[model samples]
Target: MDRTSVVEVGGIAQFIREIGPDEGASPPLVVIHGGPDWDHTYLLPGLMPVSLHRHVILFDMRGCGRSTRGLGPDGYQPEFVVEDLSQLIQALGHHTVDLLGFSTGGQVAQLFVESHRRLVRRLILASTTAYAGGDHYLVGWQEYERRLQIRAPRPAWAECRHGEGDRGVRGTVQWALDAAPIAIWDLDRLDEYLALLEGVTFSGEWLGPFREGRLHAWRPTNPEQALRDFVGPILILHGAQDMGFPVQVAQRLHAAVPATSLRVLDQAGHMAHFDQPQAWSSAVLDFLGG
Candidate 1:
């Protein structure tokens, strides 16, 4: 799994990874990760388990993680991100694929399917939003501090002490770890969960735009208007208590898309797959296989 290849689109290089069996699988699952700034590393274990059932392709959005970085706001446009994935699929020799877009990645997936409807087979929208009417769900420090009350016990905090190293990567990691009680409902593997997130790599460039108010002001021209033409199965997998996007956002998305299966997993938050790995993976497999 160490070997990776870059798929270039519009001269911007995007990183791509593949795992699990390619044969005897439904359409290959292509995953677009979260964080306009986050890389694909934090989605592991939850996603890695799905590989046992089928081939999974995970890619870091341009300017995030191991891909090309330091691209300013203009370069991180939504269309550009969609183009990168478009060419990435072509580069992988896949005509169509089952897609999973988590968090911000889910927004990218929705837009991509709208523009390239025929290239998608099954759609899984996990912990994401439609961002309609130009809504960029940004959380404030006060609210962040409020969210911290849900953080795991002090022992769990010690597991991710590495998060306090530096302002860029470390701070971002600490913030995420601080939101643990919201992330991991089943505190059984708290140490393993923190370690996995701490190990996930990140890029400073993606954060610069967010803090500068550049990325937040941007929105898709037509998130659902374009989707009116796409007549395919969409699985809306969201956390029952997702404070980040709220379950209502997922409800709206499912309502707008005529053909959608909504699965609200109990005891899960914004990161449903992380909170309920077994249930989440099984739900994904059942939907994709159906």
Candidate 2:
């Protein structure tokens, strides 16, 4: 049977939801979520299909979801996150496990794998990028803005320190709502995804810094270059129509990392799991074959 509870790890209470058998499985799959302001809820439904047979472990990072925050932006550093993951795995009595990271979560997984190379068995990077983008960093967003022709100014996270009036979870949700159109590639699925997101509970602790676009979380100095020695299975999944990171970014990442495979799902966007559930899960399941 699946398990659900909160475990205090690395000086914080982390909320965990497990699906499928915990033992006699190949290896538990740990899913790291994205968003400085979001949680793991959006991923649970899409990944449930795979969890039916394999142990699926999902948790809210400190300062997100129901997890208790440590302090503020300083507490949300990448080092602390790596420690949290390491301690959580040990607490669960797992010496090794497969990891699936989506978006910012992928950044976390990559950082963890880079540091604790021996602990992770496989790595799945879905709809994520390595660094914050290089010379072409703002190209995609610029194109999107041009197409949108929005008269209203985009919310600047760095400037909105006040958290858009409500200096709490609601403000973070506001950021989500504002970034939705830029995040989702498939315009038709925007409303449905937004509806699902409405029920998601976000953390207000880090909302201010996150809204300001101040991310001190892990980012690769050179993503592919950093993983030169990594020997584990690496799967790079991207949406063919992704506007945020774009498919080209995925291609470069795939090319840089050795022993990595890339699969681009058509008609998908930044949130491929929501935009193309069947295809997204199928690729993940196939890569994590039992």
Candidate 3:
């Protein structure tokens, strides 16, 4: 895996990891990570199979991961992030490419495709939804928060209340706040994930803009319009048990898109790629024609 930085559309430098394929391979497939706030590390291993066929490009979106941060209100808006993706594609000199977006990143990708249909060859939306307005979608968010609270660091009340001086409490608290939700399979990965989160400093500037932008709320007032607008082939993969962005959301997205295929993994939850890598990878590979 070769790591480097590239100047993308938003005047922001993007941190990218390029995994080159065997000699004389095809153009790369760009993998977009989820989380309006999360980074690219979690999606890396799951995409190895796609990398086997072509070069794989992974990057940190603005205000997330190893990418340049502190851009104030300009950085967090979903439109700008889509622009950033467009610029990155141009910067890389690719006229058209395969794109795979997970969770929130899928929303960004869908917006991008809606705006620039010619640039996308194949589209993959995994563990994501079309509109965020549905009640089922909020279930996922609530579950995420509940799980987060459980893994949160709790110090003795006396230490915090009396200021008894336990320095470790601060670190633990920070860990709980920034760390991504853990998978049941890998207990040790949480530490590594926490370390990565600590490395990327976040500016609260995007918070206000994010809340105002309402990027989390997906209300496609004109689903028919969106369907009529985009003509690219799309693949929708969702976990049957996903608490965040329930399976029904994926179904809605599939129903709306004119050219789409839907795959629901039975026993998986929110993070299908992490929870069921083999199944996820096989679906992606088959869709992309591996």
Candidate 4:
């Protein structure tokens, strides 16, 4: 059975959800969702399939989702997130777990794995990039723009910036609605992705900075070295058609980190799990092993 509760970690109330058994042979898989603005709900059903094989743990980071909020800029730092995950894991009575982070959450996973290497058994980076300042950074975005022009050509909200006028979760939701063309490769499946966002709580405090280009500010001291030094195996799972991080970025990350195994799902966009749930979950299950 799945359970949901709030745990106080690092002096903040963190909302956590768990699926499958707590004392399974394999360690629990702690998943971190992307969007400093997005909570953990969107990954449901799409990510639920993995619960059949191993326990799944999902939670919202500080200032996002149903967790503690309103701390403003200082509370949103990557260090705070890394620290919270560490404390939360210890509080949950686990010595090790398989870690998966999606999009920006993957970035947080990177930091967490590096800071608490002994706590993570395996690392999965889905639809996320290790470094945002590299020269290859623009590849996915440029492709996304090209695809958007061809697919969504002059959408009604074209003139407005994402989350424009609106603040908090609604603003991010608005941005996601506007960026649907590039978010899901199969235009027909766009509604499936949107359906998951229904009633999601967003943090305007976090969204405010995210909208101002703060998402790119996350730069690990030396990601390649950190991944190389990681104690467990790493998986780079991404969408073949992802315009945000692009397949090329995954390729580059794979080449840099010899320990990483790369999996690219076709007909999927940035939200590969939403687009191809079976393939996405199967890949994760296979990687975790029985």
**For every model in order, what is the number of clashing pairs?**
0, 3, 3, 1
Candidate 1 lands at a TM-score of 0.83
Q: After superposition, how far is residue 37 of candidate 3 from its true place, in Å?
A: 1.6
Looking at candidate 1, the ten consecutive residues that score lowest on lDDT are: 132-141
TM-scores of the candidates in the order shown: 0.83, 0.87, 0.76, 0.88
In terms of TM-score, how similar is model 4 to the real structure?
A: 0.88
Q: Per the 3 Å backbone cut-off, how many clashing residue pairs does candidate 1 have?
A: 0
Give the per-residue Cα lDDT of candidate 3 at 157: 37
Better of 3 and 4 by lDDT: 4
Per-residue lDDT over 1-290 for candidate 2, one digit per residue giving the tens place of the 0 to 100 score: 67789999967998998987766658899999988567888886568777776889999888888888647666767667778989999999999999999888888888888888799988998888886654364465675766354322333432444455546766766667667776666666666766677567676776666557765756656667656667898999998867667788888887777579999999887888888887888888899985
Candidate 4 lDDT over 139-256, as tens digits, reads 5566565755643333333234343554465566666666777878887765555556554665566766655655444537888888899968999999998877778888999999
For model 3, name the residue pairs that clash: 132-218, 140-243, 140-244
Best candidate (score: lDDT): 4
Model 1 Cα RMSD, 1 decimal: 4.2
What lDDT score is found at residue 31 in candidate 2?
A: 94
lDDT of prediction 4: 0.80
Candidate 2 structure lDDT: 0.77
**lDDT accuracy of residue 42 in candidate 1:** 80
Query: Which candidate, 2 or 4, has the higher lDDT?
Result: 4
